[model samples]
Target chain A: MNYIKAFAPATVANVACGFDIFGFAIQEPGDTVEIRRRDEPGIVIADITGDEGRLPRSAEKNAVTVVMLHLLKHLGRTDFGCEVVLHKNMPLGSGMGSSAASAVAGVVALNELLGSPLSRKDLLPFAMEGERIASGSAHADNVGPSLLGGFVVIRSYTPLDIFSVPVPEDLYCTLVHPDIEINTKDARYILRNEVSLKNTIAQMGNVAGLVTGLMKSDYELISRSMVDVIIEPVRSILIPSFNEVKKAAIDNGALGCSISGSGPSMFALSRGIENATKAGEAMVRTFAEVGIDATMHLSGINDGGARVLESY
Target chain B: MNYIKAFAPATVANVACGFDIFGFAIQEPGDTVEIRRRDEPGIVIADITGDEGRLPRSAEKNAVTVVMLHLLKHLGRTDFGCEVVLHKNMPLGSGMGSSAASAVAGVVALNELLGSPLSRKDLLPFAMEGERIASGSAHADNVGPSLLGGFVVIRSYTPLDIFSVPVPEDLYCTLVHPDIEINTKDARYILRNEVSLKNTIAQMGNVAGLVTGLMKSDYELISRSMVDVIIEPVRSILIPSFNEVKKAAIDNGALGCSISGSGPSMFALSRGIENATKAGEAMVRTFAEVGIDATMHLSGINDGGARVLESY
Candidate 1:
């Protein structure tokens, strides 16, 4: 195939008690990337959409293009050339893993265009490279889920151990994105370098409980385990109407609610579509009451991460 | 029944990565308690064995007697009287959960003697009360598993949410109790009140992985996840030849090795009895080389926690 187009779904990182370790993919509000082989000796960003001309066209500066460059280098296909186009359907800095979606889509499209040389797991390093350039840290919490789908756990970073955890089919997720921006770096900087040992133990317990709940398909256990003791207390301050939105979500029957990744975006899990929809509406209404524009999306857990849309 | 006897198995708490949150019951080296209805209206430690008279006989001072008192109070049977006897088959202050076993046995025996007024789940509070008196903290990591059997996760402490996690049938546990004592109070005091956020996240990842490993029965994942960065570094110093023992266990094909709870006792998990036996021998030899006498027990995960031995 000479050309390929792929779609990568958005993801929610941190997952409350599992900061820097857990994430899950969602179905709506994702990015699409298109790639075409060319006789030229270098990759170029030919066209972009949905970004308001704000994203850089230079391959060196863009997350997707940077990922493509790294993929080529890894595959020893540096001589290969391609024309790339990105459609940024998700808002930037929304805590919905917008950058991860784009990066995943790019590598997936490039991998397909090269006749599928790399396995799906092999694409993770390239996607993580994109994350490093975009977020100033090499974290797999976002990219792992956005690429592998379902719930992903970054078991260890030193040896790059990542695992795809099971998620129940009945579980629905709701994301409410307020029209505000909170830089990932700033949100991270707000956290304390040291955490109380007591809180750390509590967080570990909850994280283990959350994993068990997911594996057992226990909604009540999930609700009880979806608590953050170390990061959310500090980072939630950066987002407008954070507490009110969370309260609205819980009041409307959400299993649990928390800031999606950093802030300006929040998400909740529920057992059914009805509860998810009501929780999303409650969150939106809470943000609207605070004079903030918001958008909401309801989805089941995304089992398929990035995938080829078309081939030519 | 006028008299009842119960046996409570030993427990390995903390489980390396899950300090104060995780534990599992083992099959050997436990405690036995005997309870007999008395004409008087107060609980009393009528006799004791295997403790060399180091344990207090007063109901207010002894963990087993204290648990009985609380159980009686909770059952609105303060008028009820009991003569209690405790046999400490396991060594005290060895991090083998000696007190938890005694507490569990006490409650189990008393509950049986009262014609089973309290259900098994209702017995947790009494066991925790015993723990509070013995360890100066209301931690259920040891007591929960010792009473409930199998693997137990203390999801939360405020509301006392505890879950019995599944244990693989073939998994074997090996514990080596060295001839030394590390008081739980001193061991806890040695811990740093604050932990680095990076290490905290790492610990959380491992805890989640360990839970997943237990659920999925993945031995390699359990081996990789059985790591403790928050507490073991400091507590290991209190146990002589700690590193050598752990290294020997691992070298002899242990799936994982770490301090059983605080110090002086170490445990390892393996998939087969052969590996467990070898690991146990290696641990004993390592301790012996350092002039520290040790005893080893090899057995599978105990699915039955505390049970009535004989009724009269």
Candidate 2:
């Protein structure tokens, strides 16, 4: 019997202000995980590439492999395994959910290949475990959006609260990658252990305003509320021209622009494709102006995360 | 012509966990402002009650009078001079929107009495101004919900992104007003100026969850997210049996409970009026067990801040 195939898109983690509890997926720069049934009845990750030097081929170090183990353990099926292939589509270390996107693709594809035994809701914990393997923390911010697509808010980490927000059809995302690499562990270490009360309040208000901005499709509010008082500043130092690129995207009519995931890549959201293209180009130009060469991609929110493109 | 005859509810400021922004109205207890029309286009406030003679009855020292003046100035009209009598229905020095609720009522009443030139949205700034006179800081946490009648999220103070959440129709707010009072200024001072980044992240996660809870009508999520790590401990100290009552309310099927305003009063929200009644009675009972007498009232979201009761 031929098993199912699934593809999970790349996710943007950290999400500017929300740290580990908020994220969204873009249309381009995603990973594909192909899973096929075997005489074995568990989950397994077969191949890894594009991150040969960085990723683990032994399945123990790979996030996707670990999550599959977690899923099988949770289901009381200790002897379940499947041959999985990870097509590393996006850059290895581009701050665009390079690890999480791959992890999401793994678990989602495996779940579907298992006759869709577990629903998407049920797949969240397994996906979160995959994230935990990569960053030493189980956070759903990136995993949720990568698995579900569009904007997602993660309310909890232990037991994940993942939900999708309605993305207006007109909204599009512009991404700029500066070909720079910043390890997630290094980015996480740069932040302070404590934050000022004033900053915390400001961050909360910004989060609130961002929600309203997304809900009302108010580009101006979205632009204004994208200001992060916490993670980005401390982490962005590792990425060259991060601030300049953000400013450029905003000046180019993007609603709000900020560093994607842990940095080196910046994403801006705009009202339509035209604005999104302009936003992408502007970020690249600004990065170039700062002597940093960057690649920009403009795309809209993908309504579905993983599905069949076609079967041969 | 008579300018006005009724009063508006005093808003409880500093809604728990939503410090500096978020408030709700109490109908049983309120501030009554009586207005009398006069030929001169000059404002006058007379006979301020329940303030222990500490308030200025002569317009200048009175906050509501100043807010009324703000409304007139905002409208660019000089034809609103009238005699304003404020009957402070709720207790003075209570952690409520004693001044803001009055301000909201006077403006709402005056706006209706004066042929409704300004809108409901226009009244927020004036109410905030009224709060500033008492608290010495221009904040919208109290007046926004007071005027709008529901849960509110204030995105920022400088830009003033203030709006209300469409509270679920099934939600019931049970309020417990203890005899003891906590000064708002003192409550504000007692709070720790610095917060840990970990706590702040947790708080932000809760805030995000709470917003989603209200939108999705997920009472469990709302209850889980209604936690405060920054201000609640210090503020709750001023309120008698705050913890016991909150525990009792939660045990009795109330979704979640927290200090209503600054303190001395706490509220529990539940899925239905029956649970709200049980929760309200349980709160009062819990307070009695601790030798603190609290008058608990079961009420729904006002939905009407300061509307005409009979328009005679």
Candidate 3:
């Protein structure tokens, strides 16, 4: 195939108790990338959409192009070139893994056009390169789930160990993205550099419990275990109406709720789509009551992360 | 059943990645306690053995007596009394959960002598009181597993939530108790009160991975995830020949090795008794080379925590 189109889903990272380690993919509000082979021996961002020309045109400045560059370099296909187009369906800096979705779509499209030279797992480091360029830190919590789909755990980063965690079919996700921006770097900086041993142990216990709860499909345990002791307490202040939104979600039957990724967006989990819908609407209403515009999406766990649309 | 005898197994707390939250029971080298109903309205430590009279006979100072006092108080059986005897088969201050075993046995024997007034789950808080008397902190990492058997995860401490984690039947444990004493308080004091966010995230990742490994019965993942970034780095320095003993255990096919609890005892996990036996021997030899006498025990996960013994 000489050309390919791909779509990658957005993801919610941190997942309450599992900061920097747990995340899961959502089916709606993602990004798309289209790629075509070029005679020139260098990558080019030929066109872009939905970003209002705010993103850079330079290949090095864009997460999608950066991933393509890394992927080609890793494949020893530096002599090959591609013309790329990015369609940003997800809002930027909204903590819905916008950069990760674009990066995953770019590599997935390129991989398909090149006849699938790299496995899905092999492309993680390249996508991580995109994250490094976007956030100044190479974190796989978003990109891993956006690439592999469903629940993903970044087991370790130094040696790059990632694994897929099973999700119960009945579990549904509710995401409320407020009309505000919170940079990932700024959110991370607001956190304490050092956390007490007592808090750390409590955090570990909750993380372990969350994993076990998910594995066992025990919803009560999931609700009880979905607590963040370290990150949310500090970053929640940055997001407007954070407390009210969380309270609304919980009151409307959410199994759990927390700031998704870094902020400006909140995510909740519920056992059924009906409860998820109600929770999502409550979060939106809570934000509206606080004079903040918000949008909500209800989705089941995304089983397919990034995939080719159609080959030509 | 006016008089009852019981034995509780030793436990290895921390389990490398789960400091203050995870522990497992071992079959050998435990503590024995005997209890007899009395008409007098107060608990008493009538006799003691194997501790060289180092322990206090006062109920407020002794872990065994403290557990009995708490148990009776909770049951509103303060009008009832028991005469107790403690036989410490495990060494004192060896980091082999010596105090937790005594506490567990005391509660078990008293429950039996009272015609099983409290369920097994109902007895955790009283055992935690024993831990509080012994370590000055009410931690369930050791006592939970000693009472619940197998691997136990203390999900929370505020409300006292503990759960049993599945153990693979093929898994065997190797423990080496060196002839030295490291006070739990002193060992804990050496650790940093605050840990960096980077290390805490890594710790959370390993803990989640370890739980997943145990649930899925993935041996390789278990080996890879059985790592500690927060506690062992500080505590290992207090244990003599720590590095060499760990190396010997790993070299002999142990899945992982680390200081069992605070210090002076090290534990390793392996797939079979043969590997566990070899690893145990290597740990002993390594300690011997360092001029520290040690005793090794090879055992599987204790499926039964504490049980009533036939009385003479």
Candidate 4:
């Protein structure tokens, strides 16, 4: 097969108390990449769509091409070449891991076009390199789930140990994306360097609780554990009507609600699609009341992360 | 029946990364309480043993009597009376939750003598009240596991949410108690009020990993997650040759090792009794090399927290 296309879903990171370690993939609003063999000895971006010229046009600067370059270098296939077209289905800078999807799709499709030399897990570091280029730091919380699917927990980062946790089958997410942008770098910079040991203990307790609740399929435990005492208090100030939107989601039957990643996007978890849809509508309506136009997506947890779409 | 006797096992709190929130009960080295009906209208401590007279004699000051009084008051049976005999099977301030076992034993025996009016879980608050008197603050990490058995996670303290997590049947603990003391209050006071956010994130990550490791029975994950970046560094300094002892435990195939609660006592977890015993001997030898005598207790995870020993 000389031509291949792949899709990678978006992810929500920092799931409440699990800052910098927890994340999960969603099914819709993802990115796609189509790769074709080329006679040239280097990778090139042939076309880009849906980014409105906001994403970098240079192949070296884009996450998709960066991932492909890393994967090719690692496989010692530097003489190989590919033409790439990235279709951005998710909004940029929405705190919904848009860049991660693009990077995952690129590497997945390129690996397939190269006759499938690398396993899906083997491609994680290349995708993480793409993340390091997009964000200032190489955090696996987003890209891990986008590549591995389901709920991902990064136990440690030095050796890059990542694993997928069991998520309840009925768990659904309501994502409300307000038409605003918050740069990931700036959002990370605004956080305080130090936190009270008391709050730190509280955060750890909640992290354990959330993971246990997910593993045990305890909805009430999840609801109680879905609290962020450390990051949300600081980052929420940047988002408009953050508290009001969260309250609305909770009132509309969300198990819990918080800023999705950095800002301008909020996610609420519920037991079923009905409650998730209701929470999404409530969150959108709350944003509208604050004079902010917002879009909502309701999706179940995506068990299959990046996948090959078509190959010929 | 006019008399009842009960036993509550010792516990190791903090469990490396889960400071102030995680703990599990052990099978031996626990306290016992014997309760006998009396005609008087107030609780009294009639006898004490194994504490070398270090424990308080005053009913208001002792954890066992204090727990009995609280349980009696909660049940509106303040008009009733009981005579208590306390047995201290563990060392004081050894960080093995000595007081929690005593309190749990008292409540369990008293409740049985009162015809078991309250469930085992319902006795947690009174046990916590005993903790509040023994230590400066009421923390459920110790008492929760001692009362409920197995591994316990205190997700929140405000409404007192506590739950037991699934523990691997083969999981064994090696507890080394040095012949020294470090008051829980003093150890807590020595810790810094604030910690770096970076370390806090690491702590939360490990907490998630440890809880997930226990629930899924993943031994390697448990080893990786049994790290205390926030508390162990500071508290270990108070214990002599702490690093050497921990290294000894790890070198002998122990999964992980750290200060059990506040310090002077260290605990190591292993896959089976053989490894646990080897780890325990190594830790004891290391302490002896530093000229500090230490005693070791090796036991499996106690799924039964507190139980009746005799009733007549």
List pairs with backbone clashes in candidate 2: A41-A80, A41-A81, A42-A80, A42-A81, A43-A80, A43-A81, A223-A255, B11-B97, B21-B141, B22-B141
Q: What does candidate 3's lDDT look like per residue over B1-312, in tens digits?
A: 678889999999999999999999999878999888788899888889999989998877898988888888888888998788899998888888999999999998888887788899899899988888898888898889898899999999999888888978999999899999999999988889999998999999999998998888888889999999999989999988898999999999999999998968999999989999999999999999979999888899998898888553
Which ranking of candidates, highest DockQ first?
Answer: 4, 1, 3, 2
Question: Candidate 3, chain A: TM-score?
Answer: 0.98
The per-model DockQ list reads 0.92, 0.60, 0.85, 0.92
Local distance difference test, candidate 4: 0.92
Q: What value does the lDDT take at residue B262 in candidate 1?
A: 84
Model 3 bad stretches (over 4 Å)? none
In the range B1-312, model 2's lDDT, one tens digit per residue, is 465666676565555566775566655566777777777997887577777787877676678888888877888777757888777877666666666777877788777777888788778888888877888777777677777766677778777777666677898878778878777778778878788888887777777777667777878878887888778877777776778888999999898888877767788888999999998899998888878777777777776666554333
C-alpha RMSD (angstroms) for model 1: 0.9
Q: After superposition, how far is residue A86 of candidate 3 from its true place, in Å?
A: 1.3
- Please state the Cα-based DockQ of model 4 relative to the true two-chain complex: 0.92
**Candidate lDDT values, in order:** 0.92, 0.75, 0.90, 0.92
**Where is the poorest 10-residue window by lDDT in model 2 chain B?**
B303-312
What tens digits encode model 1's per-residue C-alpha lDDT throughout A1-312?
799999999999999999999999998879999999999877999999998898998999999999999889888998999999999998988899999999999999999998889899989999999888888998999999999999999989999888878988899999989999989888887889999998998898899889999999999999999999999989888887789899999999999999998867899999999999999999999999979999999999999888899999
How displaced is residue B75 in candidate 3, in Å? Answer: 1.8
Q: What lDDT score goes with residue A75 in model 1? A: 84
Single out the weakest 10-residue window by summed lDDT for candidate 4 chain B.
B155-164
Predicted complex 4: CAPRI docking category: high
**Candidate 4 to truth, TM:** 0.99
